[model samples]
Target: MKYLSSGTKYDSCNQSAICHAFGPDGRCIQLYKTLLTNYCSGECTYCPNRCERDVTRVSLSPDEITKITWSFYRKNAIEGLFLSSGVIGEPEITSQKQLEVATLLRQQGFKGYIHLRLMPGTPKYILDQIAEVANKFGVNAETTNKSNYSEICPNFDYQNDVLQRLHWTDRIIRKKRKEFRGTNRLVGANDTQFVVGAVNEPDSEIVNTVSEFMKKYSLRRPYFMSFDPVPDTPLSENRPSPLWREQRLYQVSYLLKEYGIKADDFDVVYDEHGFLSNSDPKLELAKANRDMFPVDINSASFSDLIRVPGIGPISADRILRSRPLFEEKELTRMGVVVGRARPFICINGKSQASLSDFLEACS
Candidate 1:
């Protein structure tokens, strides 16, 4: 059993990939990701798999895929299979074929974990059928800005098809959960890779879009792939996003989930130049809005708890709950990093004099 953390980086041939690895009973579960075919018809500027390129593309037959999965499963090499493919031919045809493989796996009694990627432009009925067979389904908006859709994914229409498919998939997942009643297992929903540096869109926009998806569909996970310049892609010459910027986006995303920070609240101003790249977005926000901080930890609401640097919503709640038991001195003594926390939080109505003052005291 292997467990992949949210921030764990996995080394791959062409790029470093990030994924969550779930483990059970002190053992890490094996997660296998493979593409059915690297051949694609869509012309996404940032994708290595886009059509019109002379890359070595391979497509395993359904039987071949099944055999590979069974061989690994029999040895407990993997707990599940994550199958995705570059869109080939019509979306309907490609999607149906992907579904056929998943259905066949289930028919063969291989039901460990099957997660299928739903390509944009897939029919609603086909999506439903895929949902019926798959344990999880995922789709990638790729870019958040609508204008980039044309420059990035030229063949895929953002308005009519892609958005519709996502909404329909959400509806189907909801419907299935309802039909299965309380006993039915929830089907996980995921979004695809965000090409971080391929376009000029700010991190704020990308995170906002993801936040909305999480709120709307209770999406299980949102995978962020920092844009790497793939050889021969239209935007191959484009620089990759600054690593810190990508890291901050992931941090802010965690804040959004753990601290309940709304995307709008942290929406950064670009200055007609570019997104902020100096400090972590949450730290920047906390520094800029000094008035919001030094919140009385003893009485601050859960929402207020998240406004403090280093303190997320959960920690805030823990503070509020533990206030009755621990005094301010005790909390500081309990290794809460009082120096960093002092500027943003108050202890029993007593605010820190200043960041410098708190630092001095802590030092």
Candidate 2:
């Protein structure tokens, strides 16, 4: 009776704001994200809706949620739904309600993207049901370490609650992958979110945990939430994680996952506090490996080209496919952002563009 409301601008999704979520096929689609309810049993110290907090809590029925989502889709306002909820009574109950909303959406033939947040400690049967319907699934591992997790979310079991569910998601995704090979269909991928600067954990711990998750769980990606202290929460006095810190993490994560950069390579990029610099990590790595620089754009391997800032895999492949003896202008047309890549590349055995050349172009 206490917690019933329309919408809260807490997550990346909202009706007016089109929060684009990447699908299994790597296409970005807008999502209609909202909480199913704000009621909760797990009294996490940092959350605004802890059992003791006097916030405006609300629960939307599955039908109500479906109607709103379908309406949004009908207007072409959103391409999908990202549904999460507070732990109401039992975790399973919350999970079931969310599943019901997703099921209702599917039954109504609203076959757009649906990213379901798996509640910690939810039963395996319920997990399977949700997996079948969701286009992507996520379970938030708020903190990196189990001890830190206990400090933040005291009631939750780190092993049985969080990681186990991630394991289940991985298994389901693998099974789904086997079932959906070679078809136009793209099977869902599992992602986890981390609350950066929460529990005073270092960037090293955060990235290490991400590495472990990727290696062990076949995780698709890690989402970073810069911790913002809410008034009345236990961590109200704590400082918010800088947005730049989160951005740097994404850069490092990309380097690790996409660029094939190893964890040990981070030693060159991370500062004394194990925090990454605000500068682009790719540029930092490139500058560090000076001997590898001034790479021959015409002949360098795809791997080498991507190491340079602004040169992505697609553009690198384009370079490979394009006619030999590439000119400076041709690189731009191939999607290689020459400005960023210029300092690191050589065109026909000469530096593609010098600092003065860039200055002249800018002037």
The global C-alpha lDDT for each of the candidates, from Candidate 1 onward, is 0.69, 0.80
Which candidate has the top score in lDDT? 2
Predicted candidate 2 versus true structure: per-residue lDDT over 184-265, tens digit per residue:
5546777888888867888877888888899999976787778888888888899888888888898888888998888777
RMSD of 2: 5.4
Residue ranges of candidate 2 with Cα displaced over 4 Å: 1-29, 182-186, 352-363
lDDT of 2 at 191: 85
lDDT at 264, model 2: 78
Best by TM-score: 2
Q: List the residue pairs that clash in candidate 2.
A: 3-57, 3-58, 4-57, 4-58
